[model samples]
Target chain A: MKALVWHGKEDIRCDTVTDPEIQDPRDAIIKVTSCAICGSDLHLFHNFIPGMLPGDIMGHETMGEVVEVGSGVNGKLKKGDRVVVPFTIICGECEQCKRGNFSVCETTNRKRHLADKVFGHTTAGLFGYTHLTGGYPGGQAEYLRVPFADATHIKVPAGIPDEQLLFLSDIFPTGWQAAAQCDIEPTDTVAIWGCGPVGQMAIRSAILLGANRVIAIDCLPERLSMAEAGGATTINFETESVVERLQELTDGRGPEKCIDCVGMEAHVMPSLPDTLLDRAKQMVMAESDRPHVLREMIYVCRPGGIISVPGVYSGLSDMLPMGAFMNKGLTMRTGQTHVNRWTDDLLRRIEEGEIDPSFVITHTVPLAQGPEMYQVFRDKRESCVKVVLKP
Target chain B: MFHFSNIVRTKGDPEIVKGGPSLKQPADQLARALGWFSIGLGVVELFAPRRVTETLGMEGRETMVRAFGVREIMSGIMSLSVDKNAGLWTRVGGDGLDAAALLSGLTSDNPKKGNIALALLMVGGIAVLDYRAAQDTKPRRPPRDARRKLYPNRSGFPKGIESVRTAARQIAAHAKTHLKTHAETNEVKQGDERRVP
Candidate 1:
């Protein structure tokens, strides 16, 4: 089998690798039919991620057909069932799972995914990226060994397009989580920072959840326009102060909920070197330069509002105002999205035509072109909201 | 609720009108035991404050501190358990630790032991009150919310003690996570028992 390998900083290549097998009874080996690069994958491409090393598998978002299941595997899922595997590998019955925090499951990716030669250190568990999460191999390859399959893999309901369902692996549910964190009250207004695929979905979710108004912020005309089409009031942060526009729109109360879809790679003027993580995050979302938008998210939200941050923050960075957050009584919720929680609902919405998230998927590349497509993504030339790689 | 007066206050004169034994003896014992506990805690904190802080996360600090504050109040009640002549009173005061100080301490380059030592000192302050309360007669039980505060309160300390008990169980559960991090590393060799496989 072959996988898209992350060789080093800004370095990724398609390489031949060992075929995956069922290493555990609860495991299932799947033949990946499609996969997409996640924003966090770009975090791996840049040096912001600590544990990932050269030649580690690249993509986390996947849709595939199960070819084998381990001996003790239950749930009655068969070998030929088409499924969407969630990005986070989780054991269904762990203490974390019991608390509904499935992303940080106790029995998820226990095996080191990245090859030993990549990094000198081992990590807790995560698919394909590296340690920091257990380094289990990822799905950007011909075959993917999925541990805790019953807990992490969701069957694609019949009638859904493979392209539309691919996102169920990450963005669809992540976008839903960002929206869910708003804890929307029917009359509330929401401001979403960034208008990439996830941000677009968040706007859709906010509307679906009955928000009175939705505001989308970003610099790109294409994404901003998409947001407008989706019924969101668009704000080009490059042209106007996001906080000002939001206050003016909300009659000085600010939006009830604010979300940071742009993570560390936020766009800001006179950028700092340390904020490269912010920039890298932007590039993953297919943006080039931006200051950290999380700060703006804080400045623009109402005093007693919620800030839902689903953007990936690897390790820790500086510059959040804890005192202000405390003084304002703002409730901020974050961490990796527990996609399993929202996958079923999101898929149903997609099926019902209540949403057409597939519009955000602007590029489709063959598996072999994964490397070149990444460059197109890096250059921000295609206005790519998402790039699906067909295997 | 039992009536509180200057007699239970333990004012300027160490030797008041009359009681079984002085508050000094148990106060001193608790102080000594606290010193030992402080050293052990300091060792843990000194070596791994980041581990503790990370597990505490953003909202956890306030919750943990409130819990510890309640535990301290309980310790004050437990102190009444020690000295019959001693009295129990809950001290409810101002905002405890500033966020800047909390962040600074959390991300500090200070020796782990020193951080633990400081935490122990805070822990000791409450332990002393607990020890003293143990020695006193069955004092009035305070309400849950009132007793755990470090400052003054209208409702007595018994309820505060129960709050501490609940908070302690929560804190203990959180504390076990830190221990598990180490325990997992040590057990990695023989254990293929990892839930994910």
Candidate 2:
């Protein structure tokens, strides 16, 4: 099987790998049909997130038909069942899973000790992520071995294109969660930072959830244009002041709901001194994440409002405005998406034609071209927004 | 490396059978090599400034040598980072300073003029490589002012934006009504309890 393997910083290779085998009764093997290069994958590509070793496969957004199923799957899943494998592997019997906190399912992570030390508790095992998250082989390959397959998969029916359903594995539900957690009110002005794929989806999700106005901030013209298409008032932070523009749009009260979609690697610019400082500290290994978006969101969000974060932040961040956060009596919510908690509703919405996630995909290529697409996506060349790799 | 990584894999997980071409370009490889070279050279200059100055016949300039070493180290770190282009450009500028300093030591009175000339030649060569790597490693992102293909029609809504907005409004209205009705029922229940008492 051919898979995209992580080498080091800025290095990925399409390598011929041994076929995955079912190690447990709950495991199932799927012939992957489609996968995607996620914005968070850039963190792994840049070697920013620790625990990823050389030869770890690189992807999470994946969907395919089940070629083999374990006996433990019972009748819930069988051969020929088409499913979108959610990034987080979950054992449905766990206490966290019972509470719909699937991303922190207690039984899934094989390397719980590492996560326990770093995060104070283990998170759900994620595909192709890192060793700290169980180091499972990812789905960016010809085939994937899904652990806890019966509970970890979102079964999709026929008649829908792979493009429409593939994002259900990650970004679609992730974006929806980002907006849903905001508890968006019809009169609320929701300001979202970053216009990447997740950001674009969040924009649409915010509008569908009935925010009075959805403001999207990014410097890229193409991304901003896409955000506008999704019914968001776009802000190009490169040319305009995000704080000032958001203030002007919200009548100086600041946006009631603020979303940070840019995490870890905030765009470094001379105009943003904090971003520059963060980058410097990041390069020196002093700070693990660039929290410019977090700082900006805290500073610009309305007093007593909510700041919802679906972005992936790896470790420690410096110089956060905890004073403002505490004084303003604001609420902050962040986590990996409890993918199963929202996928059913999102899938219904997709079937009802409320929104199509495929709109964000600007590039599609063969799995063999996955290596090149990573570069294109990372550089944001050719106005690239999202990349789907057909395996 | 693959074998070592395989050692960590569980029994059933796939291991690499054969490797393919890396995504890294030649220029990226060049930048990496240069980055390590810069760090190695910087460490020597930093820790052994007297040796560096003696080799260049500028014995009294150890402090300046150490300063250059710090600059080299910083540039090397940047070069090894995602912003390798900036690091390479910094190296290019550092090379200019290096050349000028070596030229200053090319005086007739200096016994190691020949050594200074050799160092200058090496700097000149490294400068060219740095400049090339810097240019090649520059991000391929389209110019900010370039004509962009805007997506005005991709609303992701198959039912059109207006219809979705209408549905959202109706949902909100229904929720409001539901809340009002529930509140009215609760008030009636309270009134009934007081009347019974």
Candidate 3:
């Protein structure tokens, strides 16, 4: 099987690897037809989230035809089922799963200890993020072993193409989940901080859920233009200060809900001493994540409103505006998106033609071109927002 | 939220799979968490001692921070490998030492005294969580039951010649059921929807 494997920092290669077999009774093997590169994968490629071993398979956004099933899978799933596997692997029976908090499932992360030490709690196993999130082989391959098959995958309708449904695996659900966290009132104003794939999805999701105004902020013209296309008021942070522009847009009340789509690697341009300090800390290994977006959110959100963070942030250790956070009476909610929780609904939305997630797929290439595409996406070289690999 | 059952059938309603960690369980989960936290913190300290020390504005004390990192790593490994109780308790004790060290930085003339104060408070909070987890879970005996439920318990398989026959029969039965179900699924899928190979 040929798959994308991580070799080292900024190094991903297309390598021939062993096809995955069912390792547990609840597992099923999928012959992958489409897989996409995620913004989070850039963290792995850049070694931001740590704990990467050579030759580890990478990629999680995937959809495929089920080729095999383990007996424990019972009768609900079978061979030849076309499905989109959520990145978050969950045991439908866990306490968290029962409560619909499927991302922190206790049973799947074999390396919970690693995650626990850093996060102070165990995260549910992710398909291909890091050892901290269960280093299961990912789906950018010829075949993938999906755990908890019945609970963790969404069976796509027959008429849908892989491109239309593939994102039900990660970004679509993530964007929807981010918006869901905002607890948006029908008339509320929502501000999103990134224009990447997740950010774009979030903009549309907010509209779908009835936010009166969705404000999109970013430095990239392409991304900002895309946000505008989605009926958002765009702010080019390079030319305008997010604080002033947002204040103008929201009549100085700040956005009722502020979502941080840019997680660990938040960069603020035009230079603040604070931003420089954050960079220095990351450079010196003092912090693992950048908190610029989070800090700004705390300041920009309405005093009693929510700051919904969907960013995959493990930013600079222990550096936050606790004073502002406590004084303003702001509520914060964030976690890895419980993909199963939102996939079914998002799938329906897609089926209804409410949104086309594939609009974000700027480039589609063979699996072998993944290494170059990683660089292209990271450097923002070619108006790229997302990349899909076909095997 | 969607009508998955009415619309399509998956492997099973895994929520009713008769196996999951109870919402009320604890112990091993806590101890392992403490152990890994220690390792993660230690790795950061070992590789970036200057970063830790400089954050405290105790620029010249990088070596001391590295030594502390070594202790954290050892304690973490102990919590992971040795007696869970002792390992957790050791972590709690290490917390005390860390508090004292941070207090020293606070009292010292490090220009970023505010940072040192915050660091001390953070360490103090972690200490409280570690102590509680340590107290809740006793050391030594593994939480084998919880683990067994999460994974299949393979211990009861027969060891005698009967084991071979029993295992073979299980395999044969699974294959037979698979073929029947698959044939049925294929038929339904062909008529009701698109079936992908």
Candidate 4:
């Protein structure tokens, strides 16, 4: 099998690798039809996120037909079942899973001790994320071995194209959760920072969920344009003031709900001194994340409003304005998306012709070109927004 | 290294059979090598400044050497990071400073003029490499103001945004009606209880 393997920082290679085998009874092997390069994968590509080994396969957004199923899968999954494997591996029997907190399912992280040391608890194992989350070989190849496959997959209908259903594995649900956690109201204004893929999805999601207004912010013109197409009033943070524009749009009350989609690596610019400082600290290993968007969100959100974060922050962040957060009586909600919790409804929405995630995919190529696509995606070249790899 | 990584794998994880072309370009690899070289040179200049000054016959300039070392180390760190282009450019600037300093020591009074010339030649060579790496590793992203292919039609909505919003509004209206009815029923139940009492 050929897979995109992480060699080092800024180094991905399409390497021939041994095919995955079913090590556990609940495991199932799938012939991956499509996978994607996610924004979070850039964290790994930059070698910012720790725990990736030299030979680890690099991807998470994947969907395919089941080629083999272990006995423990029972009647839940069988050969020929087309399913989108959610990034988070969950054992459905766990207490967290029972509560629909699938991202923190208690049974999946094979390296729970590492996660316990770092996060104070184990998160659900994620494919190709890191050793702290299970160190599972991801689905960026011809085949993938899905652990807890019976419970960790979203079955999509056969008629839909892979591009339409691929994002159910991660970003679509991630953006959905980001918007959903805000609990958007009809009169509320939702301001989203970072118009990346997740941000783009969040824009459409806020609109669909009945927010009175959705404002998308980014430095990239193309991304801002996409957000505009998604019914969001776009703000180019490079050219204008996000805080000022958002306030202007909201009649000076500040947006009622704020979403931070730019996580660890906020764009470093001279205009944003905090971002520069965060980048400096990050380079020195003093901080694990750049919380510029977090700071901005807290400072600009309406008093008594909600702050929803679906961004991937690895570890510690510095200089957060807890004073503003506390004084404003804000409620902050954040987590990895329990993808399975929302996929069924989202799938129904997709089937019912409400939304099509494929709109975000601006690039599609063979799996062999996955390495170069990582560079293109990271650099945002060719106006690249989303990349899907066909295996 | 792949074999070493394999040691950490559990029973059924895939192992690398044969590696293929890497995403890292030649210039990127060159930048990496230069970064390590910068760090190594910086470490020496910082810790053994006296030795460097003695070799170049520029004694009593240890402080200046140490400052250069710090600059080199910072550049090296940046070069080794995702911002390697910046690091390489900094190295190029540092190379100019290095050449000027060495030229200052090229007078007849200096006993180690030969050593200074050799050092100058090395700096000149490294400068070229740094310049090349800096140019090659520059981000391929278009300029912020560059005209781009805009996506004004990709609403992600199959049914248009208006329809989705209208449907959501209807749902909200229904929910409001249901809540109003429930509240009215509660008020009536309270009234009945008070009358009975």
Candidate 5:
């Protein structure tokens, strides 16, 4: 089947990869209907996440119909049921899973059983990524294998559009997790450190959770404006020192809660420049772009406030002031969203018309135009919010 | 004065009195009280820790820890902080009086300097516990997998076969139910809340 393959640095092309078949009883073969280009996808183009081999099919955020189910598959899901598959493949019943922590399932990457022992103490298998996550193929193809189908895929309610349910794969739950992690109290002031799609989603979620005021910080005019439209006060870090402005607004205490929507690839100075050229190339053009926004998040947060970082960060992080964090009594939380935990509620909310997370999508291109959309998105065009690739 | 001998007989040993309440429990209570006191000071410090420290005229971190530690210990040892009338520990006169003066002395000292010391002391214990947890040597936990046991154990399927079989059975049941409902044309259809394709 044809899949968008990540060959090498800055190289992604629609190519014919092997069709996915159900190899395990708990597995299901899904025919892709919708997939998206996440900011993290640009990482492959930029070579941020290493071990990128030729013939790797990219794109994790996807929703599709079950074409076939393994003999042992359950949950009453059947062939043709539309479902949203989580980016992280998990086996739902390991020590971490029995405790409701499915992200780090022990048997995640195995074809039939858990790995011989385990991978590096913690193992959560993910799609289309290399050996670090057991290298299960992703869903940017005509058909893809879904492991632990009962645990990973949630059938979408009928009334919800495919575009809306597609984000349930990663971005929606991630943004919700970011806001929930902040633990913002009612009427509390919040400053999200990025205004990307995830950041904007968090902004809306912050309001949903009753944060009376939200100040969004980003260098992009488009993202900042989007934040404003989503009911958040905007801050352009490029034009002003974020900490100083936030302090001025908060009577010198800073925002009571801060969520870092920008992860490792944040548009900071020197090594991580937010220059127009870089933003155009990385955020707009690349398929896997994750820029760290941690420095800004810590700067504008109030003492004793919560800091939630849901942006994808691999291996290591830098430019952090542990002393300041410890001294100020800030509570820090960083991790991948447990998407399955939020899918039911998010789906219900969507069905009820309570939230239209699809507002972030400003562009929808045919699946074949993925290569072009990648460039348009990477260019940081003024009009871009999110790109939905319809298959 | 309520003497130790008047209320109850000492049982553990002559020197180590068992009948009279020793300072340990009282000290623990005082330590807890001090925790709340420091938090109140912090609330004020949030507005102005420096002001509180200056008004109290206390030393910095070191002095605050010793002073707060000594205060809690003295409160526990004497039971004087809890009740002023019970001053048996103060029978030592001048030394006891000097120790008893500390809590009262807080208001007289520069609030800025006093809070600087007290906050340091108050936060120290929690810091140590956190630091120890960080330094633990346990292996980083391995990730978990959930597919191994997808079925209820009561079902007569083998452990390995249970999950897939149970899932298949459930899927078959759903299909059967849907077919039955559709075939029975006379049956009324309540809107299925969980609509699936």
Candidate 6:
């Protein structure tokens, strides 16, 4: 089958590859219907995440119809079932899975020792991520091999189009989890950084969870407008200081919860000795991540509040203000979204017509043009916020 | 909840899912072991600085020894929180710092010069392991044209002519029957199809 293969940083190609088949007794093969390019895929595109080899298939957000299933998944999944496979692969019976922390499932990492040496423990298997995860072929292809199908896939009704349900595989749950982590109260004020797909979802999620005010920050007019449509007050970080504008927006009291949707590869501005220095250091491997948004979150967040991060942070970055963190008694919470836990609840919300998640999709093209659309998304051309590919 | 009478087998080899990673490299395991070794030694030094200085026979340098312990603990934590390449390099840097500390002991006129020599030997041994780990995890730049296979004019189809999605629908119409049937079948359980908007 044809798949998008990663060649090098900034180089992706549409190529013919072997179709995926069920490998594990608990696995199933899905004929991919709709798959989207996630912001995290840009991390791999930039070569920030370690261990991405040539020929690695790249994608995560996907939903499809089950073409086949292994016997081990016997009463749970059947051939032809419409399902959205969570990016995090889990066994469903591990201690972490039992505790609803499926993102940290232990049994899936065959190379746990590699992560163990770095993260003090291994995380769950993720499709098409690097050797850091299981490196399973992603859904950016004609078909995908989904392991632990009984647990990892959430069956969506056939009537619900792939466009609406596909985000269930990643961002919808990711945004919901980030909002949930804030432990929001009805009158709480929430500030979100980066108006990307996840940030837009987070804005809707925060409102659904009853935040009185949601401030969305970004320089892009389109993204900011989308956030506004999602019921968030907008902050243009390019023209205004995020910290000062947020402070003014909240009447000198910073928002109760701050969310960092921008992760390790956050862009820094044209400033010297700060953003430029960080980019230089990041390029030369001085740090594994760019923590610009993290620093801003720490500096601008309300005292004694929650800074919920749906962002991905890998390796080590420099310059955390430990004194501010200690003095203000801030509580920080972040992790890969425990997608399985939120699937049932969020699907109900989607089914109920409380929101339509697919509104974020700005471009839809065939998989053959994925390499080009990636640049369009990366460069934010044609007002692209999200791109969905039909394979 | 879904079922079809016939399994539609597509073209090409069914990729076997290797559920997890391959075996851990020898150097990777050694790097982890060395990380633990640093934590253990650092703990001992932090809590028993006197004993550490006495063992190295640099008795008067208890404060400096404890500071080195703190550095060692930080290094161990760093080694445990990054990729193997970064972790191993951090270890190399730590080893250099350690060598400098031991050289200070070498000129101290201390009683256990042999013990300091032993410490240096241990550092030398671990440094070799750290070096090996770094080499093992180093980023290998691929050739510019690697992984760039383009099937021009072939749209991911078995026929190698039409676009992939157009061909998918021909098989997909057959597959959708199974899904619609399965959806109908599942609705008997939760009346879910009725609820699908």
Among the numbered candidates, top lDDT falls to 2
Candidates 1 and 3 compared: the better one by DockQ is 3
The ten-residue window of minimal lDDT in model 1 chain A covers A115-124
TM-score of 4: 0.97
Q: Number of the top candidate by TM-score? A: 2
- Model 1 stretches with alpha carbons more than 4 Å out: A111-124, A271-291, B1-197
Each candidate's TM vs. the true structure? 0.62, 0.97, 0.67, 0.97, 0.62, 0.68
Model 1, range A178-247, lDDT digits (tens) per residue?
9887887667888999887788878777766667788999877667777876668889877787778889
lDDT of 3 by residue, A1-391 (tens): 7877776655577766546777779889999999999999988887778876655678899999999998899876898889999999999998999999999998888789888897788889888787788777788877888988878888888987788899989898899899999987666899999999999889877876667789999877667777776768889777788999999998899999999999988763446567766654564467777788888899888899899888897544446887988999999999989888887777876787656777677789998888888877886766678899999
Prediction 6: B-chain TM-score:
0.57
lDDT of candidate 5 over A91-206, digit per residue (tens): 77778777756666767854323233332455677777654666566776667788788777888867668877788888888888888778766558988887777887787677
- What is the lDDT for A119 in model 2? 97
**iRMS, model 4 (angstroms):** 1.0
Global lDDT of model 4: 0.93
Candidate 1 lDDT at B143 equals: 29
Model 1, residue A233: what's the lDDT?
88
Model 6 C-alpha lDDT per residue in residues B1-197, reported as the tens digit of each score: 00110121112323322212222357656767877787887888888999978888778878877887886776665454333466568779889988998888886577888888999999999899888878886644333334422212211112221232233344456666888999888879677666778
Candidate 5 or 6, higher lDDT?
6
Give every collision pair in model 3: A76-B10, A76-B11, A77-B11, A117-B37, A289-A315, A289-A316, B85-B139
Can you write out model 4's per-residue Cα lDDT over A1-391, one digit (the tens) per residue? 9999998888889999999988889999999999999999999999999998888998999999999999999889989999999999999999999999999999999999999999999999999998999898988999999999989999989899999999999999999999999988899999999999999999988998999999999988789899999999988887899889988998899999999998989999998899988987888789999999999999999999999999999999999999999999999999999999999999999998899999999999999999999988898899999999998
Worst 10 residues of 3 chain A by lDDT: A267-276
Which parts of model 3 are misplaced by more than 4 Å?
A268-270, A315-318, B1-197
Candidate 5 chain B least-lDDT 10 residues: B9-18
Cα lDDT tens digits for candidate 6, A79-193: 8889998999989999999999999999887568777887899999888887678666678988988888888899999787888899999999999999999988656889999
lDDT of each: 0.64, 0.93, 0.78, 0.93, 0.62, 0.78
Runs in model 5 deviating more than 4 A are A111-120, A268-292, B1-197
Better of 4 and 5 by lDDT: 4
